[model samples]
Target: MAQLSADADAFGPMLTIEQAAERAAEHITAVAGSETVPLAAADGRVLAADIVAPVDLPPFANSAVDGYAVRFADLAAAGETRLLLSGRVAAGADAADVTTENRAVRVFTGAPMPAGADTVFMQEDVGLDAGAVILPAGLKRGANARPAGEDLPRGDTALAAGRRLRPQDLALLAALGLTKVAVRRRVRVAIFSTGDELNEPGTALPPAGIYDANRSLLRALVTHAGAEVVDLGILKDERESLVRRLREAAADCDLILTSGGVSTGEEDHVKAAVERAGELAFWRVAIKPGRPVAMGLVAGTPFIGLPGNPVAVFVTFAFVARTVIALLSGTQPVRLPGLPVRLGFAYKKKAGRREYVRVSLAPGPDGIAVARKHPRDGAGVLTSLTETDGLVELSDELTSVAEGTIAPFLAYEMLTG
Candidate 1:
């Protein structure tokens, strides 16, 4: 992988998608800083330290249902047993001390069990007559009770470091009465789009100009990968402007991303600007719809250059850019989630490069998930992404796929999260 960028003419061929990802992971490193933030602000952030349970979950033994708390010894002794009604305990109320023989205490769900009670019976199962209660038969000991630390005990590791915080994690932290948590700092990313024919949205289009869609698409994807985006807007296909932005972004950002102007053409400035400002590590990957991807460093800040096509930007970002961003954010490299799905449509291809086809899922004859390729397979077809559910990844060695072949499927929801 290193030799692929060092020698120009000696380079044999483009690298595969897996090879590109491995090289990118080796080149990228995590930021070293961390901060303490409120739990509300910790969503999507990676944990910098292990989270230990400060106290036992549910801290005390409690009742799991609305029932009568009693001494199992009293119920186990004889044919028929009756107990005197002592008192009622609701959730958050103090537990009553039961000492006298054949006495029971009324307990509601989540209420602390009485000091001398060892069992519980549903209120409907026992008959309450006047001042005494007739306990039901066939009641088991230690039933309908939640013991202390049933979920998590004190001093135990609740969550390990490098784990991405999600909504359910916030709930768990809140349950432990944690107000703030230590987390790795968000990776700051500087992003821009290049091309003379690209214009901002809501503006009048020139003779051959089209609105820039790659910037918005990449910005959203970067932010979704747990990085804060610094939008540099659109730039012309000029080396001077591109170099200036690269230098400025390197000063404050951890990484830089540019769409378009990566290929070898007179209008392409990203490749030249990166070479002048710093170093372009490698370019050109052996993958369909996104063969001209570029990666490098600008003043020590990681840089990734994606193709100008909207769908190309999408596919390459899912496989390459997102993994780099994860590593840069003090976390582990996460591979795209893949599942096996039967193909409902037959497809043929040459066995040289990897390809990803937009597809939707349908129920096969055997009631299994089937991948149905979208009608449009063009790299510039943005509508195809919206119409499909995910992507079907084809390997470089497999030439054709039969209608019932089981292939790898990557869902759109997994790509962003």
Candidate 2:
């Protein structure tokens, strides 16, 4: 991995969420969206290019159900027209011999319609005899016969580029007899936690110290968002160690993520390291619990340093880090899908920044009401995040929101696991 520049301040400004998003988008453009695989292997992957149907689906007129293929015109004068059974047609049968007029061909589901047959009448509507079957009333021409290219036309673009492969798309492609596909390559990402006091899970928690949770959270988050996560583990609060791990991460990973050690303090080696390797833009966001976010680059690798506080970690991960990841992955990322509800109590915030407040939506006289902050205020309180159902988004301009005020609450269920 390339060593981050020892001179950290040269990368650029500490970007806001919006600025980081733009840079991330630019970074994503550098990646080549080219990869090909089987249709069965393209699930959840973005299409590298448009997929044209190589052949018409079904490729020929076929039977839609178990019935007899017949010519509707031959039944004009009779209550039931008895016709000799020419042959039985089953799926995958290659027999293409044309059936003579007034002859009914026994056809099963998925069987290609014999040439010259214009209609199919259900078996239940036919009286089966030793050598022939009698077609009953209500039989119509062109009924239950699937026409050539009816499902899809030859050379038609069935799927467009930049679309994520879905289950139905896979099935459709499989039906077209396509064995492979082209897709956008996966985004490579690396994550590390910085703190001497932080310990990995399974280690004893000494007094005044805690196990590292942010890394686990981030790894889960990155994987869920469709990026591969390289675990860099926890780095002790040492500048030299931070630089080494960061450089290694930057060298191999397109995105390097770390939680903690970016704030303005002597121990904040992450900010210093990021500046030494790339650039750090500190964003003074209006959002509660996640105001301190660092967006920078390390050795040309985009470095996203989040807050050490657990609640802050969750907020920044969803709103800020997620957007960066999405942009890096060549997808347009937006805020969580929100559900409109009324605030149960009064709340206030300073203008010019967005706020995300942990809230528990309650049942009220009208409907679901948002109320009560999580018990803890420290950014380190992970329990506060788990206990809340969602976060109510408060715009910066609103100095105070009175009770019963309607607000947009982004449900935690929608944003987090």
Candidate 3:
């Protein structure tokens, strides 16, 4: 655990999204240990070391199509050239047994190319004349023939360290004959929600009580970010109980996460409870839906407090908590790439604060994507997330956007693992 900036004034009262992200990255570092797991279970786990290829991909030259393997020199410059059938090679068969002089060998896809064969003519492109095959002169050299090491050469890096393995990465490792891989251990996070008004989902709600959606939302978001969750359930506004839980969670968890009770409301007790346990900093990030995000250390464990609104919780988790988890899990952080889309509706926002507007996309008259704003703009509207394709990001410098404006859009798929 490294010492974070204790002076809140050093970061100022308000920070940009980029500045907050940089501060978190500077303070919290990857502390996860490494473990070797079988390839089948390695998906979504970050690599601990680079994976070097042990052998050349497609170790031997092979045919790319079911065709006749022939030497380029044996074909005529124009018209067609007929060659006697030498031998046949199917997938998994040896090509050394074929005779290649002034003759063509029948080859199938993935079959090793016959010795000295430089080209392949698809069976449909040539005619067979009584135990011989006719090859067209126009066929280029090495056509339909796959060379050895075409995909990756031996000793080359197959995957880099810090890469979160996907299904396709698993295929590449499997092709290199790897059964297991070394990856960073999953990050352990203790999560909970605050406010006595928050009730369990299964229990009946009191007059002023609503079911706690943030806890379930946080759990899913944390798990999707590749961190294990220790659910602490909901904590009331009592400072003593909150302090006790925070200390206990920080003792074993790598990160502590909570929703609500971080704002400046009189009833909010999480801020004081965190101070009793450890250090806490209230960051007024220039972002809509979520602004009063609290971050600090609880008994040496990093802690993050997201907003109470469901939409705010989703937005903040995607941008803030997601980055923190990536760092703690030893995974390389990747910025979510946004796609350019034409705005179908006009929008206005305050300057110096980044805002994410929920939008659904549809093809316009010209077949280009047109982003339409969600009907409701409330921070607590969960349907704004479920019914939309993604968010239209409004930068801090931009105050207004007119219809037909080209905006950077981030799809929901890009935000999740």
Candidate 4:
């Protein structure tokens, strides 16, 4: 599991969102070294080693069309170069008879080019007689012929280790006749939420109770990140059960995440249970909606204690969770593409802490751009984040920005799957 050692210092004071994120990335323990998994099951899985080309791609010079392969020098004349067609070669057919001097060969797409042939002329561009295929005038000297080793040479590293396998990667491996490949095992993450007052959706709320959306939302984010999410179900405010469930989940999960009982004053038992079972490190973030996000470990499993507030939970998952997972997987964490756009409205930042202002995007004079400030309030509000295009990254260094000042926008699309 990926939890930090007790040697890591706990959060001391109020931390800026960036500082909290950096701390989580540094302190969380990794889920051990990577191990190889089958290629059939490796899609979206992180790679464990570099894939070197076992053989030269295409293996040999091949035809890229169904036509005639001919010598370039032999086709210098304006009229057709009536060279004898030594033999026909379709894909999968090995050349039985090589094209002799100044001769041509009838070749199909993907077929290995014959000796003495420098180019291919499409069949439609050439005329065929009893035993010879006539080439058209001006047929280029080297047309439609893919040279051997043009794509890759043997012993070359075609794909770097730690590279995520995309569809194209799979296709390339298939072309190389590889049935299976080694990939990093998927990190298993366990997720849930806490609060005796919380109920799953579809259940009638008994007054003060709220819907348990954190577990589902967090589960989706973890799975979409190429992890195996073990749903531990929702836990109540009891410390013993919380500790028991955490111990159970830690047996097989690399990380454990919950959405409540993190703040120092919370009577809820998640924080207490973490301290009892393993470690509890809290970071009081300085951001608006995500300030209460927490981090720690439970029974050796890296623990992510997001605030019960929906918006805060999602925001913290994006900034902090992604960083920790990327570090564990040895994958480079992807920073959201922050595009500079003029704020349609004015916004003030908390003097010493960076803030994320949700904003809707619109087409500006140049191209796609974003507007400023939506509901800058409670973490429970999800509508603003959903309605807006992204978050406006208001740096702590800047106390305020005018209506027309350009500010960097981080799209919500970049945060979630």
Q: Which candidate ranks first by TM-score, i.e. highest?
A: 3
Q: Candidate 3 on 1-417: residue-level lDDT in tens?
A: 744677778888888888888888889878758999999899989999999999999899999999999999998888889999998999999888789989999999999998899899999999999999877778889999999999999999999998888999999999989999999999899999998899999999999999999988888888888889999999999999999999999888899999988888889888878888998755578899799788888878988888889899899888888988988887766786689899999988999999999999999888779999999989999899999999989999998999999899999877877
Candidate 3, superposed: residue stretches over 4 Å from native: none
Cα deviation at 298, candidate 3, in Å, is: 1.6
- Write one digit per residue (lDDT tens) for candidate 1, span 1-417: 111143323333587888777776666778878999999999999999999999998798899999888888888565657888988889999885545357888899999988878788888888888988888678778898887888889899998999989999999999988999999999998999999999999999999999999988988899899999999999998899889989999998888888899998888889999989988777888887798888878777888899999999999898878888888887876675589899888988878788898999987778779898899889889999999999998999989988988888999988888
User: Scored by Cα lDDT, where does model 3 land?
Assistant: 0.89
Residue-wise lDDT of candidate 2 within 1-417, one digit each (tens)?
212333324434433456545555644443455678877667767677888999998799888989899887777575668899898899888548857487999998888888788798888878888999988877667999999899999999999876657699999998999899888787788888888888878978898888998988888888777677888888888887787888888788878888998778888888888767666544344456776677766767777888888778888888778777666666567555577888776777776667787878777676666576666656777777778888888876788888888888887656643
Q: Give candidates' CA RMSD values in order.
A: 3.3, 5.3, 1.4, 4.0
**Each model's lDDT:** 0.86, 0.76, 0.89, 0.77
TM-score of each: 0.89, 0.74, 0.97, 0.81
- Cα misplacement distance, residue 247 of candidate 4 (Å): 3.7
Clashes of 4: 0
List ranges where model 1 is wrong by over 4 Å.
1-13, 72-85, 96-103, 122-141
**Sequence-dependent TM-score of model 3:** 0.97
Order candidates by TM-score, high to low: 3, 1, 4, 2
Rank candidates by lDDT, best first: 3, 1, 4, 2
**Which is better, 2 or 3, measured by TM-score?**
3
Candidate 4 C-alpha lDDT tens digits along 1-417:
554546435566677766766776776644456766555767767777788888888899999988888888887578767777787898988775775467778789999888778789988888778777777787666789998878888888887876767678888877776777877667787888898888889989998988898888888888767777888877888888888998888787787778888876667577778788887676566766676666677766777788888888878888877777766665656776688888888877668776777788787887747485675556787787677888888787788888888888877767764
Clashing pairs in 3: none
Q: What is the lDDT of residue 397 in candidate 3?
A: 93
Could you tell me which 10 consecutive residues in candidate 3 have the lowest summed lDDT?
1-10
